[model samples]
Target chain A: MEQKKVILIIDDDPDIRSALRVMLESAGFVVGEAANGEEGLKAVQRIQPDAVIIDLMMENVDSGSQVAIKLKEDKYPGPMYMLSSAGDAVRYNIDARELGLAGIFQKPVDPKVFISTLKAKLGVA
Target chain B: MADSSGKYSQSVLSKIIRFFLRDEEGSFPVFLHSLRLEDQLYDFTIVRFSVAFLIIAGSLFAKYILEISQLNHYALIILAIILFFANTINFLIAYPARKKKEKSSAYRFLLIFILHLSIATDFIFLTIALWLVGGVYSPFQTFFIFHVIIASVLFSPLISFAYTIYGYLLFLTLAIVSWKQWLPPIFPIGAVPSDAPPTGKYIITVAVVQGLLFFLTASLTTHLMYFLREGQRQIVRINKDLERLCDQRKGFLQIALHNLRAPISAIAMHLQNLLYGYGGELNDNQKSWVQRSLTRIDELISFLHDLENLSVMENADLLREANEFGLNDLIEKIIEENQDLILSKNHEIKIELPEGKIFILGIQRLIREAILNFLTNAIKYTPPNGKIIVRAYRYSSCVRVEVEDNGIGISKEDIPKLFREFVRLKNQKREGVDTTGSGLGLFIVRQVIESHGGKVFVKSEPGKGSIFGFELPIHIKK
Candidate 1:
C-alpha cells in the first residue's frame, strides 16, 4: 500500500475550491483547502503537502502568484501550479519559473489532464 | 473683490476667466483650470522682455549711431530697464500659481486679472512715453496698436473693445492738449518754445486717422478671435462626446466579459464533474455531447482571455513603464517555463542565443507577452513532432529574435490575414488542429512589438514551414 499524495487547493471562491477538491479527492489524493494566499501559505507549512494549486486572482490580481513567490522564498520543497482566470495576461506578466510554478491551469481546468500531471509527477499509482 | 476663494469662484469675473482659461471648452463646474492656457502668459512675458531688449538697443542706436540729440537716451534706457525688472518679478511671482496640480478657480481669476492689468499698464506707459516725445505727433504713438492687439488676443473681446475706446479717448485728450500747446516743447523733441504751434484742425485730423487705425486693429483681431474660439469649442465638444462613447464601450466590454466568464467557468466545472462521473454514469452519446459543450466552453474562455489581453495591452500605464532587460535571459526563462507545453506538443525546440548578453529597452511585460505569443502561436499552428528553432542575436544594429517552425505554413496572401483581429481563416483550419484563435493573439503581438520600436517579420509558403520574428534596436548602457 502507498501513501496518498496531499494537495492544497487555495481559492477565494468556495465553489472552485470544492470543485478542485472533489477532482483531487476522487483521484485518491488527500485534498487540503485554504480560502486565500495567506492561509494557503500557513496551510502549506502545516500540511507539508506534496503539491499546491493556487488561484491567481484570489482577493487581488497576482496575489496568488505573489504567494507562490513567498512560498518559494521560504524554501518550501513542493510542486506548485497556478490557476489563472486571465490566461495570457497572467502568463505574460509573471515568470512561472521565477515564481517556481510547475505549470499554469486555465480556469475550469480539465480534471483528467490536471490529475494525470499530478499523478505522473508524484509517481503515484 | 475681497470675497473668499469659495465665493470668488462663483463671482462673475471668475466665470469669465474660466470661460477663456481652456482653449477647448468643456463642461462647466469642472475642477482644475488648464495649465496650458496659463502657459501662454509666459509667452506674453517673453514678448515683453524682447520689447525691452529692442527698446534699449534702439535708444542706444539713436544716441551713439544716429546721433539724435532730441531723443532722451537716459530716460528711454531707464524705462527699458524698469520694464525688464518689472516683467522678471511678475513672472517669478505668478509662475507658481498656474503650475499647481489643483487650481482653485479664485487663483485662476487672480491670474487672469494680473495678466490683464499688466497689458493695460503697458498702454499707460506707452502713453507717457508718447507724451514725453511729442504726444499725438510722436513716432511711437502707433505703438499703442500693438498693446491693443495683445489685449484682444489675451483677454475677451468686450475687454479689448473697452481698451480700444479708452485709447481713442486718450488720443482725443492728447489732441486737445497739443492744440492748446500745453507742452509745446515736449521733452526737446517737439516744437521749440519759440516756434508756433499747429492748428486745432490739423491736430484733430491726425488724431482721427490714428484713432481709426487703433479701432480697426482691435475690431478685426477681436472678430477673428471670436470665430476661432467658437470653432475650437465646437471641436472640443465633439471630441468629448467621442471620448465618452469610447470609454463607455470599453467599460461595457470589460464588465460583460467579466460577468460572462464567471458563470461560464462555473458551468464548465459542473459539466466536467458530470462528464467525469461525479453525477453518475453516462452513455456514450451523453459523453460525446458533454465533450463538445466543454470544448465550446474552453473556446469561449480563450476568447475572453484574448479580449482582456487586448484591453491590457492598450493600457497607457503598461506602455509607460519601460525597463532594460537581457534578451537572452528572458528567452531562456520563457523556454524553460514553457518546456511542458512544448513537450506536450512533442515539438523539438532548438534555442540559439547570443554568446554575450543582449540588452533591450522596452516595457518588459509587453515584450514578454509578444515573444510568448510568437512561441505559442508557432506551437499551436505546427503539427506534433514539428521542429521549432528560436534564435536571438544581433542583426545589424538591432537585436533580432526569430521563431522558426517546421509545420503547416501560410501563403503570402494568407499571411496578412493572420494578424488581423477577429478574422478567422477558412483554409488554415486543418482537420486535426484545434484552431481556437480569437484572431487577436497575433494582433496583440504586433501591437506590443511595434510599441517597443520594433517591426515583426514573417517568411513562409503554403507548403513549407513558417518563420515569424521581430527586430528591436539594441539598447546600450551608458
Candidate 2:
C-alpha cells in the first residue's frame, strides 16, 4: 500500500485554512495547516509535504510570497503554489513561473480545478 | 515632408533676416525677450506708427502756422507716407499670428524682423528729412527723444542703444558735411545769419546731450521690465512645484488604498468559502450570517476600489497615457457588465449610440469606471420593470454621454449635492434595492470627467427619472 501524499496550507484566515484542509482530506490526501508565514515555515521543515499552498497576503503584506522565497532558498523539495483574491495576477505584474511557483489560484478556488492541480503537483495520478 | 536640405535653407534664410534686422546682436537685460513678443511688438509698432502719423500731420500744421518753408512741408509729407506703410505691414503680420498661437521661433523672428525693419527705416528717413529741413537747427529734432523712449520700452537696451547711436551719428554727420560744403546747404528755411552762433558748435552740443538722454532712458526702462519679468518667472516656478507635490501625495494615497484591498479580499474569500460549505456543512442560520458578512465585505472592497480610482484620476502620470478609443465600445462594455442586474430587475435597457464609432482621447479605464458608476446608480434606483437608457452622441467639439433611468429621482436641492464625496441621498435607501454603496461613486465619476477637461450634468425631479452624463472633447483622428 502507498502512503497518502500530504499538502501544507499557509494562510492567516482560519476559515480558509479549515476549508482547504477539509477539501484536500476529502480528495484522499493528508493536509497540514499554519495560521501565518512564521508557522508556515516551521511546518514545512517538520512535515516536508509533497505540495505547499500559500496565500499572497497574510499577517504581514506579501508575507506568504516572501516565505515561499525563503522556503525555496532552504531547498524545500515540495512544489509551492500561490493563492490570491486581490483582483488578477496581471494586476500585480507577477509571473508565477518566474517566481518558482508551480501555479497560482484565485480564491475562492474552484474545487474541481484546485483538486486536479493538487493531484498533478503531488503526482498522485 | 521637407528633408534636411529644405530645413537647412529655412535656417539660413532665418539667419539672414536676423542679421539684417540686427536682432542677433542684442542679449536681453532680463528674460523678457525670451517670451512670445511677436504680438506685443506688432501691437506696439502699430500704435507707434499711428502716433508718428499724427505727429507728422500735426507738425505740418504747426509749420504752416509759423509760416516755415515748402521744403519742410514736403519732408513731413514724405515721412508720414513711409510711417503709414510701416503700420500697414504691422497690421498684416497680426493675421497669421492670431491664427497660430504658438509660432516656430524662425517664423516669429521673421515677423519680428519685418516689424523692426519698418520702424528702423522710418527713423532713418525721418532723420534725413529733419536734416534736410534745418541741418543742426531743425526744431523737429525733439522727436528723437520720443523715438528713443519707445524703442527702449519695446526692445532690449542694446537694440535701443544701437538705434540711438545710429540716429546721433547720422544727424551729426549731416550737419558737419553741410558745414564743410561737401553737401548742399540744408537750410530749408532762410540761411542762418553769418553772425549767428557757429553751426558746428550748436550741432556738436545738441548731439552729445541727446545721446546722453537716450542712454539714460534705455537703462531705466530695461531695468524696470527686468524686475517685472523675474517676478513673473518666480511665480510660474512656484506653481509648478506645488502641482508636483500634489501629484506625489495622490500617488502615495493610491498605493495605500490598493494595499488596503489585499487583506479585505482575503477576508471576503474566507467568508465565501464558509457560505459555500467548503469547511464542512453549516446550519441555515450560520449560512445566512456568513452570506450577509460576505456582502458587507464586498461593499468595503468596492469602496477601496473607488478610493484607488479617485487617486489614479488625480495622478498626472496617468493623464499622459490618454489615447483615442471608441465611445460605442465603452458604452457597450458597461451595458454588458450590468446585463445580469438589468435582467433581474426586468428593466428595459436601450442604447442610443452614433451611427458609427465616435472616438475620444482619454484614459479608457478611468472613463469606463465613470460610465460604470452611472450605470450602477441607474440600476440601483430603478424599480422592477423600470426603463434605463444609455446614449452617446457628438456635441460640437465634444462627445456627450448620458445615462437616464426612470427610477426614484432626486429633488432639485439634492441634485447639487450629488457629486460631493460620500454623499448618499436620504431617500435612496428604498425597499427592494441593494443600497450598499461607497457614496464615492458620483464623486469619482465627476473627478474623472473633469480631469479629462469635461463637464458633468444631472437633471432630476421627484418620482421622475434622473439623467446623468458628461461631455468629453472628441479626438480628431490623424
Candidate 3:
C-alpha cells in the first residue's frame, strides 16, 4: 500500500483554501489547510507535506514570499508554490524556481493544469 | 440755437479728426511684428504730448528773445496750431483703440499711421518755424536729430530711414526755396543789418552736416532695437522646448505608475478559473457563457490600461483634431456596453435627453471614455435596484452631461479627494456589497474634461445621492 501524498494549502481567505482543498483531494492527493503564513510555517515543520501552496498576499502582504525565504534559510527540503491576486510570479519579478519553489499558480487556480504541474515536479507516477 | 451750433461744430471737428487718423491702406504688417500693439499706441500718446509741450515752450522763448525778424508772432501761432492738431489726432487714435481693445491688423495699421503722420507733421512745422527765425543758422536745428532717434526707436530700420530721408528733403527744400528767393522772405523780427542769412557754400555745408547727423542716428538706434528683439525671440523658443520636455516626463511617470501594479490581475484569474472548469464541474451551458464573458472582460481590461496612459498625455497639437459628435448617441452606446452589469444589479436607469442634436467638438473616443468611467462608477456604488438618471442639455454657452444616482453618496471629507489618483476612501460599505476600485477613474475623467477647455463638477451627500457631470463648450459652425 502506498502512502497518500499530502499537499498543504496556505491562504488567508477561507473560500480560496476550501476550493483548492476540494480540487486537490479529488485529484487523489490528501490536502491540509493553514489560515495564514505563520500557521503555514508551523504546518511545514509538523506535517511536512509533500508540497506547500502559499498565497502571496496574506494579513501581512508579501507573507507568502517570506515563508519561502524562511524555508530556504532553515534548509527545509520541500516544494513551495506561490499564489497571488495582484500579478503572476513572472510579472511580479519573483523568480519562484530560483527561490526553491516548484512553480506558481494564480488565484482561482486551473485545477487540472496546476495539479499536473505539481505532480510532475514531485515525480508522481 | 446756441446748443445746436455747439453740437454741430463738435461733430464736424470729430469727423475731421477721424478722417486724419483712419487706418492706412496697404501698410506692411511686418513692421508691427516685433512691437506690442498696445505699447506702441501708449508710446504714441506720450510722444505726442511731449512734442507739443517742447514746441510751445521753444517758440515762445525765441519770441521773447526777439531772435526772429517780423515773422516771430506768425511762427508762434503756426506752431501752436500744429501742436493742437498733432495732440488731437493722437488722442483720437489711441483712446478708441484702447477702449475697443482692438487687436486686429487694421488697428495695428492705425497705430503705425499715427507714428508716421505725427513725425512728419512735427518736423515740417519745426523746420518752417526755424526758417522764419534765422533760416539755415537757427539754433533749433538739433531737434531734427531727436526726431530721427524717435523714428528709429518706433519703426523698423527701413521705415526709420525713410522718415529720416523725408526730413532731410523737407529741410533742404525749405533752405533752397528761401536761399534762392523762390518764396517771399519773412526775416526775423530783430535782425541786424549785418545779420544777413548765411549763403551759398555756408548753407550747403549746414544742410549736408544735418543730413549726416540724421542718417547716423537712424542707423544706430534701429540696429540696437533689432538686436534686442532677436534675443527675446530666442528666449521664447527655449521656453517652449522646456515645456515640451516637462510634458514628456509627466507622461513617463504615468506609464510607470500604471504598470507598477496590475489592477486586473484578480479578475483575470477568476475568469480563467471559471472558463477552464477549475472552480468545479460546470454544465455545458455555463461553460459557454463564462467563456464569452471572459472575452469581454479581457477587452475591458485592455481599454482601461489604454486610458491610464492616454489621460497623462498633455500634447495639445495631437489632441486638437476634434470632430462634431452627438452626445445622445454616445451615451446610448455606453449604456449598451454596461448592459450585463446593470442587469445583474437590476438598476433602473432614467435617461433624459433634449430634443434635436446636442453637438459638441472634442475627440469622440476620449469623451466616450469619460462617460464610461462615470457610468461604471455609478453602477458600482449603487445598490441593486437603485436609480440612475443621465441627462444632457445645453446650459448657457456649454452643453452639460450629468450622471445622477441615488446610492451610497460620498462623505463630505472624501469629496475633495475624489479626483486625486489612487485615493480610495476608507470605511466604504453598503449592506452586503463591498466596493473595490483602483481610484484612477475620476482622475481620468477630470483630465479628459479639463483638456477640452471645460470644467467638471460634483454634488454629493451621504446616503441621499451623488451627481457627477461635465460642461463642454458648444461648437457652432460658421
By lDDT, the best candidate is 1
Estimate, for each residue in A1-125, the C-alpha lDDT of model 2 and write its tens digit. Answer: 77999999998877777767766876889999998999999999899889999998777767777888898888888789888652333123344544677777655554556787778757787
TM-score, chain B, each candidate: 0.74, 0.61, 0.52
Residue B349 Cα positional deviation in candidate 1, in Å, after optimal superposition: 1.5
Task: In candidate 1, list every pair of residues with a backbone clash.
Answer: none
In candidate 3, the residue pairs with backbone N, CA or C atoms under 3 Å apart (3 or more residues apart, or in different chains) clash, namely B68-B188, B68-B189, B69-B188, B69-B189, B70-B188, B70-B189
lDDT tens readout by residue for model 1, B1-478: 2334345366777778656542333334322222255666665665678888988898788678866557776777888888888889768746775456787788777767767777777876677666666666667777888778877876678999898888777777776777787665464443222224558887868877888898899989999878877887898999999999988888888788777876787788878988998768899999999989988987887688788777776553644577889999889877876665676677999999988998988877677777877898788888888899999989998988999988778877788787777777677777545677677888887877777888888898765688889999999988
DockQ of each: 0.42, 0.10, 0.05
Of models 1 and 3, which has the larger TM-score?
1
Q: lDDT per residue, candidate 2, B343-382, as tens digits?
A: 6567899999998788988777678778877887888788
* Chain B TM for prediction 1: 0.74
Q: lDDT values of the candidates? A: 0.78, 0.72, 0.71
**Which 10 residues in a row give candidate 2 chain B its minimum summed lDDT?**
B23-32
Would candidate 1 be rated incorrect, acceptable, medium or high by CAPRI criteria? acceptable
Q: How close is candidate 2 to the true structure, as a TM-score?
A: 0.55
TM-score of chain A of each: 0.94, 0.93, 0.90
* lDDT of each residue in B1-478, candidate 3, tens digit only: 1343234234666556445443344222222233565556655665566666766776666567655546466556667766877678687777677557547887688777776777788788777776766666666678778888877877779988998999888888878877887866666545423355558897688788888888988889899878977887898999999988887877775556345433344455455566666567789899888767765655455345444434433443324657787788878755753454465567899888888877878777677767766786788788888899888998998989899988889999889898877677887787734366666667777877887878888999988889999999988765
Each prediction's interface RMSD?
A: 2.9, 6.9, 11.6
